[model samples]
Target: MSRFTTACIVGGLAAASAFASTPAQAGYYILRWDNTGICQVWSEAFTFKPIRWPSGYKIVSRPVPTFNEAVNLQVRLRRQGRCTL
Candidate 1:
């Protein structure tokens, strides 16, 4: 291959490898009890399967908001009589 072509291929491979090696940003969520609207817990990371949350609890996906916002929302929801432990 030409020198320029070889350089381009190598650079492209390097960039691809770098991107592939980087880890994806994880999402956070809250699990609030359906009956009480007071008992709430934060998940360690996002998941599809049922987490270890107690029975009658619902998952609140908070993937876009900041961590503080997620926590605050959970507290606010509980205070507003939305859900409980």
Candidate 2:
């Protein structure tokens, strides 16, 4: 097979894998500024299964609009299965 064909095949397989795991392995994350009075900022990163490819992954930084919102978002993200590692 040609190199293009091989790459296409690999990509297709990876896409399938990501799609299959997305429902079970997808997640999000959030960050909130704490009492340190903006002096301290919270940040986190997580990866979720891609929507259409298995080896595919999504890495995102947690974002929070307000301090209270941050806490709530964090909880939601955790429950959603956000990847910590």
Q: Which one is best on lDDT?
A: 1
The alpha-carbon lDDT assigned to residue 39 of candidate 1 equals: 46
lDDT of 1 at 8: 100
TM-score of 2: 0.28
- What's each prediction's TM-score? 0.47, 0.28
- Tens digit of per-residue lDDT, candidate 2, span 22-57: 744223333222222111224333343223322233
lDDT measured at residue 69 in model 2 versus the true structure, 0 to 100: 61
The residue-by-residue lDDT of candidate 1 on 1-85, one tens digit each, is 9999999999999999999999766555676665555545454554565545555666764554457767777777667766553
> Which residue pairs in candidate 1 collide?
36-83, 36-84, 37-83, 37-84, 38-83, 38-84, 38-85, 39-84, 39-85
How many Å off is the CA of 16 in candidate 2?
0.3
CA RMSD of all predictions: 5.1, 15.3
Q: Global CA lDDT of candidate 2, please?
A: 0.47
